[model samples]
Target: MDFRNLWPSLDLIIDAGPIIQNQGNRNGSTIVDLSVKGEYKIVRDGCAKDQTVKILKEFGLKEIHD
Candidate 1:
């Protein structure tokens, strides 16, 4: 209520509750760091870790563990 009171002329104020997702099975997308040559840092797993690993190996890139 305080927020609205401060901004009486506000046009939009979304709650962000309706579009939230807690979890999902499939990997949204693989995020890998390719800064080091022939090496990769698995920043995030996408389509599951197995699939992401396979792709890295195919590209002759080794995963760096941190």
Candidate 2:
């Protein structure tokens, strides 16, 4: 099935944990925890920055961190 355009149509709760430690390097090198809840639960760790930025851009969601 074609599901590329499918987007959630429910209330979503997103939570992000603080940076725990630096993973050696200084280029955004740290471990972070994230969770998203809607109809299902989604969890991620470490680096999801790139993908998250892309998704946000796709939805024209800028100034999110500002």
Candidate 3:
């Protein structure tokens, strides 16, 4: 059964309709890794993977992959 109608009343949902439609809430903004010092990871590629890498390198931040 189609569940799109319930989205409006649902408290939480992971529907990808918005994402597929290019209407994401964050517009692909990458998030910073603040758990460690002097290191970083791309939590979300968002819409700026290239830009994120450029800034990370400019600041000499090490990228860690877990």
Q: Candidate 3 — number of clashing residue pairs?
A: 0
Ranking by lDDT: 1, 3, 2
lDDT of 2: 0.38
Per-residue lDDT, model 1, residue 17, is 27
Q: Candidate 1 on 1-66: residue-level lDDT in tens?
A: 356565776543323223223355544555667778889897876554565577679979887888
How high is each candidate's TM-score? 0.51, 0.31, 0.52
Clashing pairs in 1: 27-47
Error of 1 at 42 (Å): 0.7
lDDT of 2 by residue, 1-66 (tens): 864454464234333444344455223322222222211111333444544555545766542220
Between candidates 1 and 2, the lDDT winner? 1
Each prediction's whole-model lDDT (CA): 0.63, 0.38, 0.62
Q: Which sections of candidate 1 miss by over 4 Å? A: 1-24
Could you give me the TM-score of model 3 versus the true structure?
0.52
Output the lDDT of residue 42, model 2: 19
- How displaced is residue 12 in candidate 1, in Å? 37
Q: Point out where model 2 deviates above 4 Å.
A: 1-46
Rank by TM-score (best first)? 3, 1, 2
